[model samples]
Target chain A: EPEVTQTPSHQVTQMGQEVILRCVPISNHLYFYWYRQILGQKVEFLVSFYNNEISEKSEIFDDQFSVERPDGSNFTLKIRSTKLEDSAMYFCASNLRQGGNQPQHFGDGTRLSIL
Target chain B: AQTVTQSQPEMSVQEAETVTLSCTYDTSESDYYLFWYKQPPSRQMILVIRQEAYKQQNATENRFSVNFQKAAKSFSLKISDSQLGDAAMYFCAYRRSAGNTGKLIFGQGTTLQVKP
Candidate 1:
């Protein structure tokens, strides 16, 4: 089965540096999403992307966060300035359809560590 | 807004035995989707099973099955003839049916330990 794939399984960056997490969603998927989980916390939604635009975002997705679909298969999330609290496991997911009833497949998350 | 709750923080079962994890949610929307996701040591989020709120019959996938009580707002996962590979953190999630965003709200996970 086809699955979502994320690059740089682990990322380490300075506190004030910028970081970009990349994902390659399933070829046929139309909707993409980003979620994050603190070490011991629940997975929280960050943003959703469709048609080269952001469809929805959570309060956690603030000014520092931005998502781009630079190419057909590549979807990237960039953080302008990293904070210690921003260290977490970032996951990318995609679904074939628009409805929530459609199940979204996930990639093996990228673990972001801020120094 | 919707919220998913996984009551059991941790559970244990023998290799061949059975185990059940409990989940509950609060949502106003009548139509939605409920999902169970497993995150193993590798941190890969895998979809275990799914249940549509509109379906009255329970959803089952091989050794994994769900007891979905829509009216009671409860969704529980049962693993039969558990294997060591089943040991992982299980998460319960909820998603709305009408929204185009397809965002999922996940509950705090339940850690399942399967002894060999």
Candidate 2:
């Protein structure tokens, strides 16, 4: 089965530095999303992207966070300035449709560690 | 705001027995979708089952089934004849059915341990 793939399984960065998490969603899937899970916390939605634009975002997705589908297959999430609290498992997900009704497939995720 | 709650932090069942994981959600929307996802030790989120809020009948997938009570805002997952492979973290998720961007709100998750 075709699955979502993410790059740099683990990342270690310092506070105030920038980080970019990359994902290549399942081929032929349309909608894409970024979500994070703090240690011992629930998975939180950050933003959703479709048609190369942000369709929706949560409060956690502040100005420091940005998502881009630079090419047909690669979707990326960039945090301009990382904070200690920003360290978490960042997941990339995608679905075939734009609506939330479809089941979203998630990648293994990129673990970000900020010191 | 939409929130999913998994009251049971942990649960265990003997192999070949059955187990049920409880999940409750708070949502104002009339039409939505509910999902159960399982994360094994490998840490891959796999879709176990799904239920559409508008449907009254529960959804079943082999040994896995869901009891979706729309009125009570409850969506519980039942695992029948549980196996050791079923030991994993299960998360309940909710999403609005109408929107183009289907962002899922996930529960804290229930850690299931299947004893052999």
Candidate 3:
């Protein structure tokens, strides 16, 4: 089955440095999202993208965070400056359509480690 | 704001037995969606099953099923004929039906251990 694919299964970055997490959603999917799970914490929604623009975002998705669909197939999340608390597992998900009943398929996830 | 809670942090079930994982959520919307996702040690979030608020019939997928109570804001997952591979972290999630940004609010998660 077609699936969302994320690059760099694991990443290590120093505090105050920038990091970019990339994802290639299913070809036919139009809606994309980014969520993060801190160790031993709930998975929290960070941002959602559609039509090549941000549709919505959470408080956790502050100015430090940005998402882009540079190419038709590539969606990326960039953190301007990493912090220790930014360490977490980042997930990329996508759906064919935007609706409550539509299930969003998720990628394996990228583990981000900030030192 | 919406919230999902999985009271049981960990549960163990013998092979070939049935196990139920509890999930409760708080949502004001009349119509929404509930989902159960399994994350194995590989850390891949896999959709196990999904239930729509408007659908009274419970949703089931193969050995995995969900009991959804809309009025009570509860959705529980039941796994039958469990196997060793069934062990994983289960997460219950919620999303609004209308004006949805495609963002899912997930529960803390429940760890399941299948014993042989």
Candidate 4:
């Protein structure tokens, strides 16, 4: 099966610095999403993008967080002025279409360790 | 608001045995979907099985199956003939069927330890 791929499986960034996590969703997928799992915590949704704009976002997705489809294939999440609490495993997911019945495939995830 | 709960923090099964992981959710919307995702040591969330609330019949994939009780808001995953590869952290998730945002609400997760 075609899978979503993420770059820099492990990222270590200093506090107050900007870090970008990148993902290449499945080629034909139309919906893309970002989620993060803190150590020993549940996975939480960050944001969803479709038609080149954000469709929905969670409260955790604050002003410091932003997502963009910089090119045709890459989906990126940029965090400005990272905090220690930002250290978590970030996962990118994609679905073929809009229906929630369609399962979203997830990438291997990028482990962001903020110092 | 929707919340998924995995009460059991951990479970264990012997090789060739069967084990069931429990999950429950609180939601007012009747039309929705439930899922089981497995994340091994590698940390990739892999979809194990899915159940649609509208469907009365439970969904089964190979040795994996789900017991979905829409009225009780319960969805559980059963893994049969468990193997070493089955050892992973299992998460139960929920999603609303109505919206275009297919964001998944995940449970805290249950770690499955399989012993040979």
Highest lDDT among the candidates is held by which one?
A: 4
Candidate 1 residue pairs in clash (backbone atoms < 3 Å): none
lDDT of 2 by residue, A1-115 (tens): 9999998899999999999999999999999999999988899999999999999999999999999999889999999999999999999999998664579999999999999
- Candidate 3 per-residue lDDT, tens place, A38-112, comes to 999999999999998999999999999999999799999999999999999999999999885788999999999
Per-residue lDDT of candidate 1, residues B11-93 (tens digit) = 99999999999999999999999999999998889999999999998999999999999989999999999999999999999
Q: lDDT tens digits, residues B26-92, model 3?
A: 9888888999999999998998999989999999899999988888999999999999999999999
Runs with alpha carbons beyond 4 Å of true place in candidate 3: none
Off by over 4 Å in 4: none
Q: Summarize candidate 4's per-residue lDDT along B53-94 as a digit string, tens digits.
A: 999999999999999999999999999999999999999999
**Candidate 2, pairs of clashing residues:** A98-B100, A100-B102
Clashing pairs in 3: none
Per-residue error for B106 in candidate 1, Å, reads: 0.3
How good is the docking of model 2, by CAPRI class?
medium
- Winner of 1 and 2 under lDDT: 1
Single out the weakest 10-residue window by summed lDDT for candidate 2 chain B: B94-103
Q: What is the C-alpha RMSD of each candidate to the true structure, in Å?
A: 0.9, 1.0, 0.8, 0.7
